[model samples]
Target: MTPLITDPLQPVFVIAGAAFCVCLMATICSPALTLFSQILASAQKKVFYDKFARQLATMATTLGVLCFTTMAAGILHTALEEPALFEGPLRLPLMAALGTLTLAFALQVIYSLTWNSLKKNKALHRLFGLFAGLSMFTAVFLSLGLKRTVLAAGLSIPSSAPALDTFLAVYSIPAQSVFWPLLAQALLAGTGAAGALGLCYLLLRREADNYGRDYYNFSTAYCARCALIPSLLQTIPAALLLWMSQPVLSPFALENPFVLLWAAGIAIPLLACAGWMIVAVSAAPLRHKPAMITAPVLLVAGYAVQMFAALRVYALI
Candidate 1:
């Protein structure tokens, strides 16, 4: 089977897409962590804000900008390359995605910029963070639906009858079958990225900021624990996605050496990172400095391998 993309720019798009995914996930998850800190560690809210949430908010803002820029560029590229793609049932969803993304970005900026001013009003500020995360998740949901619509188009599936039906279809079971698994994978991947990034940030600041070992310990443990839940649970969705893909790629997966390599590439680092995180969280004083440094590198490697493998598979199909 021929690949889906034949353009010379395919590599660029793939890289950009992967980066955009990471940025979007970070954008969504950062604020979520902020909200979690606000709610769960309310007593330590000041320390959390000073040490973690504040920086996370800034990172989320920067990532939100990158996500918006990349998404807009992608949309424009698609519109220019294949105008007909937007003329079909995907138009509504596309519009919804753009709107949601814009709203998310705006909310993120407001949430970040108002941090100092809103310090006195924690309730309102947390609401802003919560809404920002929700809007970003909605954008992701609509984008995924748009992707499914494009795939359905390729398969010659008919568009829904009602003008709004396609938009609403995402709420149905069949749509959810696709959505849920992807969502799980995303949460797993996103939180992994978040944890890795958080750890890296802490490592960089540890010496220069002189925040004290106690602060670093708490932050490191916090980030690892946040990522731990998703890392452990990711197998369920990973298995589900594999099961779903079997009908299409079963033979390819079994026969192709590269597939096996890529699968291993995805699993091993993730497991190692998860195991390291467990150790980091369980140990007194959170001692794994090397793991803190390497976690982000491992995550990027995993994402890179996953993207390459996916692109290769798409090419063959």
Candidate 2:
């Protein structure tokens, strides 16, 4: 069938699915990286790195399972609805992929638990990561493929796709016409993005050690500052897009496609540039032993953006 995304509800599926996939990718790949780092550390006879790697592997695995569960739940929830949470030729394929991801995540969790029970070593962690990687890769691919088509059908995506004209057309409204519910949805979602970014940062030091790469070492001192780099890179755009689109702005804006497109188009590059600059600064060569001081400052800045956007949206609503 021609994979045409038409329903207004399609954006929800697109956004949720994409978010799940991205989170899943991080969860899966992180463990493998952790395991690899452990091996590197072991070869160098570095106990600290090795221990950190083991802990990271376990944490990554556990978190992966949680993210997978959340994504799976989202997919299942969308799939089982009567009229269908979304309609498109790709829907079935997307559902099937999500189902597969769910199974992969479940299996990885089981494998990690078993490995942890058996022993604590690079081998066990590596094995678990290998399994998770398979699922993560699949989720990432599916998400990338479905993103534009899904959003074009009126779904949410990172503001990276071609401008969404038709979708915006449906939600067109004067700024003054926006309403409470619309603002609430935008604010809540944006706030969620900000919160998620914060959590991701707090866990970064542990996660980077999992990679056990020279870069990982380079990243350590900056951990305090660079911790939220990845999550911030991911979240800022989504939050801004939500703010600009004002889908909940009002009945009129909710039905206009142009505003949605404008929001997304503008937010994408801005966030990307901002994320890169922050990460670059954080990753810069420095002799700081503890990452605490710089990291906190950067994190606060990132979180502030999210908080401000959410509040602004709320006020508008």
Candidate 3:
């Protein structure tokens, strides 16, 4: 009698959403960091920023489209799996989430489309870019909050709970506790994701005739620096995520070998990849591939492990 979405393909959808979330956050944050990098950057560094900043914005906008689409589909699947949870007071949060998503999308689109054209009004353009990132954060925050509520409604409380709303309200206290962990992962992992992507792009262009050797070195260093911190911090939050889950100790979920296998088969390699990225990037201005280009492997593993684990925690399996 399992719901189709929850038991069958839900993991797939959630994993896809996570991947996009990582990409979107990374891309969105990159340009903002680039903007901030300007103040402290040398004249030579500033020139590099000026050339690539707009391209980052464009990439962010494109990634946002994929992020939102996958997220929307995930939401729909979750809603269909548990229709009752989305009905009452929860609807308010859902609507707010949609509102924030729409606003964020509009802002990002404008920011992307007008990147070069809006340079005439520097302050306004910067404001648009800044707000676009914030709006995205807000949207993700609200959506994840509601999702946690729905998940708790299904997995945490007794079936005889007075009302789903009340269960959600009370459950939210514990649920909200995980927000920091979630946010930390998104931001840090996003940065690492973006940095990894930047490395790939820079490595590809390292020998190109158009850009000077100095710019290449500068960009390689910058991207390496950006990738380093996130790679360092990401593992901590990821390790703590299950412990932070509301009602984390379900009888159904206890002592599951899948979790262990996932840890061994997936998380280990992911950590290795993260570590490799750090070491590779640390040796910055790398003219050739560093760390074996494991991003594709990590991406697939990330999608699978996250999807499988979430489904298990949510009792979707």
Each model's lDDT comes to 0.68, 0.45, 0.61
User: What number of clashing residue pairs does each candidate have, in the order they appear?
Assistant: 1, 28, 0
Lowest summed-lDDT stretch of 10 residues in model 1? 153-162
Q: For candidate 3, which ten residues in a row score worst on lDDT?
A: 260-269
Which regions of candidate 2 deviate over 4 angstroms?
A: 1-26, 82-88, 116-125, 153-317
Query: 78-181 in candidate 3: lDDT tens per residue?
Result: 88997865665555667777888788788878876875787677678778767877876777677677676666554554445455564356436554477668
Q: What is the overall TM-score of model 3 with all chains considered together?
A: 0.71
- Top-TM-score structure, candidate number: 1
Rank candidates by lDDT, best first. 1, 3, 2
Q: What are the root-mean-square deviations of the candidates from the true structure over C-alphas?
A: 3.8, 12.9, 5.9
Q: How well does candidate 1 match the true structure, expressed as C-alpha RMSD? A: 3.8
| Greater-lDDT candidate between 1 and 3 | 1
Arrange candidates by TM-score, highest first: which order?
A: 1, 3, 2
lDDT digits (tens) for residues 1-317 of candidate 1 = 44434676766666556656766786777777777776765775457545577766776787667777876897799899999767776567778888987898898899889978988998898889889889877887777766665555344435554547766764454744645787777767776666666666667666777877677777777777766666556656765665565544547565665456457646755654655566565655356767666665666555655666655654432
